[model samples]
Target: MNDQNLLERYIHEVGAHLPRRSRPDVQLELRSLLLDELAARGLEADNPADAAGVAELLKEYGHPEELAARYHTEQFLISPLAFPAFRLSYGIAAAVVTVVFLVGLGLRLNQGGLDLTELAGFLGSYIETMLLNFGVVAFVFYLLEGLGWIKPAKTGAGWDPHKLPAVKDPDRINRTELLVGIFFTIAALLVFNFVPHWIGIVSWHDDGIGVVPILSDQFLTYVPWLSALWVSEVALKALVYRAGRWTRRLRLAEFALSLASIYVLYTIVQNAVIAKLAIVDGIAKFALWILLGIALLESGWQLYRLLSGKANHPLGVPSIRENQ
Candidate 1:
């Protein structure tokens, strides 16, 4: 990643931990400060670094949680000196709400089977009560602190930067995209293999709803191989989602999948009869060719990225160095 990308990621992580109303302002200021810091140290923001390369600076700056806390405490409703007590009080009250909710649920279950409507109402109330409890407790503390009636006994003197976490990468895959891919992939696998006829147009008859089989017998021959590839693709996507970043191995795996996809698409367009109907076959072949082109482009880019290591940081959490 470039110095600028790293700077943005660090700021983004900090902003994610910040309250919604303060996020944009905090991120903007944080970005400016980080850029200034990098420039002061003679670092070039436009140039690509072998790593985030600013791990040391980030560590010394503060952990995401601590930095967010520092800003959060300074908000209008809360001050740093009163924050510890406010947090403790809120925690205790929240626990009481949970206990009350659980007790009510137990009583209802013991009396009779809880219907869905009653269960939903109970859940709604539980959520509302918890939020109400939090607001009440926080407001009381806020007032007490404002009136100088409550304060922390001592200020924190030994916060550790070593306990900090990490940030994002430009190459970071979208988890929602992966989840959607998995869903479509699995659905296709089921439809193609177990219910091939479902792919065609649906018709409503006097007897019942009917579906005409659109896939040719040749598709049956390729089902096992295609299903295997689809399954592999889903598995890899799931792994990337779990890791929250792409690693070298995952990139290679995806590249390999792209190659396999290109092969399957090429073969289908050239040799396989995807649809028994003439017009459908023509349309399917055209679509397959388009997919093949996309696969080739994606594979080439993946190989280039692997070789160049242009973005030095692989996906997942970009690790920051601990204070020495």
Candidate 2:
């Protein structure tokens, strides 16, 4: 494509990644700046070197997602600069909690599901544990950011343009999303393995709202397998976040997980009385079936993507490649 097309495409890609609220204004500013720069260099569609010029200009601009991140003011319990590390720490804490509770529950409970009183006790424990762990992490980060002890990386004269990451595919993995996924995966593993009663019915009480556990005896039997699958998911997501892109092996691993999910869901839906309440049990089963379908679809897609000539490869740093 010509230089104008390349410029528009680049703007489109960056705009696609930006938050909707800021997208239009950012895209407009980005387009005007790029066009002006191109004009100053006399690099237009008529110029033979236009494509290379546009690419060079965009490379200097930075990674699309990084650029989009700049336009965003969105943050969580902490600044985005500190969030990636905090998320990993959160996942580790979740895993620790899961392992400890699972061991304790295994020692305390028999082969059957928890009774109403036992479920209530576990619910209380869950509330207390959540408050402690989540509160500590949130408070510490909040204080750290508020104190300006944590800050974004500084860009200066020493910064190397060649250090810019390779131009990612449109489906580039979002590290924040992956990190959050890892955190939630571990949380799922913990909740199901320890406080299975967490997923229950909500009702009004004299004091306040209360939950009646929907978990059944048959569901307890699958706890070990579900825990293993969720842990695997967390590990895979963590690896992907660290790698910053998917590799052939990672895609294969994801495919395997997708297949495993399909099998587990399929098995569970087969006469599995997963919940105690009839309505809840039917909804749970239906949800499993829906999940099973999704897994199957994902498995098929992964297989096709794997067999296709265009498989995911490791991301290369742009400057590193240019230097090499």
Candidate 3:
């Protein structure tokens, strides 16, 4: 290729990856730089370009992706200011998607019995859901950043160094645990309400396919209360995230939720037959009993901690005296 053609090709490749707003200026600057570099190397642009020389010059300039990367001053979707929020949102989304997909797969296998066609359809739908959600989250954050709605915590006129609190024990309000709770609660609510069909089993016989629901029809009756409980937990977690510390009120709220959840579990487990799998009916009942036992133990633990004051440090904000 001639020198002009080679340079234009290189410029086009680089420009392809650049943002449309800055592409024209970037291309012009890149072209000028390439021409200047060639002149410095004593390669005449006027002559038919040697393939070897063009290759060497492009190599020195770096790969198109690397060159384009240097020009990216702004983040593609999420700015640094909104990164923590974006991470939390994406994490919750990912967790919900995974749980829904797994639940759907399990139900399909248990109810209809598995076929390759069904499995492929489920996988394709899962991938599409994940990609769509990821794009939506990223675009929302990008729009927020573009509109100057989410500024860095330390920036802007309202921020004050003097108002910053002293560092307390890092154990207070475990962010990771809170995030996990929020994710699972949201996932459970989604599966229970919007996608109840995903909680069943599929079986295959010589003649046809059969579907058996894992949850009893009565399970639907508890969904509204269960959903409310989950929504409250999410709200509490959001408050903790905003405050960056756990308060006494939050601890009390959590304790109340735990108690309510234990009660709900008790009522649900009393039915003895939540799932109707022919082979695993006994095992499923055993699992529900085990879950009830765990909830009881958790409630006892919470009560003991509340009374003994052990839960104060982990779930309560440190006092000013404690910080000293």
Please report how far candidate 1 places residue 84 from its true position, in Å.
48
Highest-lDDT candidate: 1
Tens digit per residue, CA lDDT, model 2, 1-324:
332356665676566565545555677678778889989988883355566776678778876556766876776566545665566777687657755665455434323347889978986896688668877887888898889987545443333333433344523589988888888888888888888887888899899998888899898898888888898898898888887777788888988988887788767777578888877776666556555545665688789877752354211111223323
lDDT of model number 1: 0.69
> Model 2: how far is 201 from its true place, Å?
0.7
Q: List the residue pairs that clash in candidate 3.
A: 110-201, 110-202, 111-201, 111-202, 111-203, 112-202, 112-203, 113-202, 113-203
User: 176-224 in candidate 3: lDDT tens per residue?
Assistant: 8888988998999899999877777778999788765686666677788
Model 2 weakest lDDT span, ten residues long: 313-322
RMSD of each: 17.2, 17.3, 22.8
Range of the 10 consecutive residues with the lowest summed lDDT in candidate 1: 315-324
Of 1 and 3, the candidate ahead on TM-score is 1
TM-score of every prediction relative to native = 0.48, 0.48, 0.40
Task: Report the error of model 1 at residue 108, Å.
Answer: 70
Candidate 2 backbone collisions, by pair: 162-319
lDDT tens digits, residue span 1-324, model 1: 342454555676566556655665667677668778888887755556613446566766766556666786544576544555567788788767766666566455534438999989998998898889888987887788768886333224343323333454556778888899999999999988898878886799999999888889986788888998999998999898988878888888888988888887666666777888988876666556545645665688788877765344432223333111
For model 3 the local lDDT of residue 265 reads 65
TM-score ranking, high to low: 2, 1, 3
Off by over 4 Å in 1: 1-168, 311-324
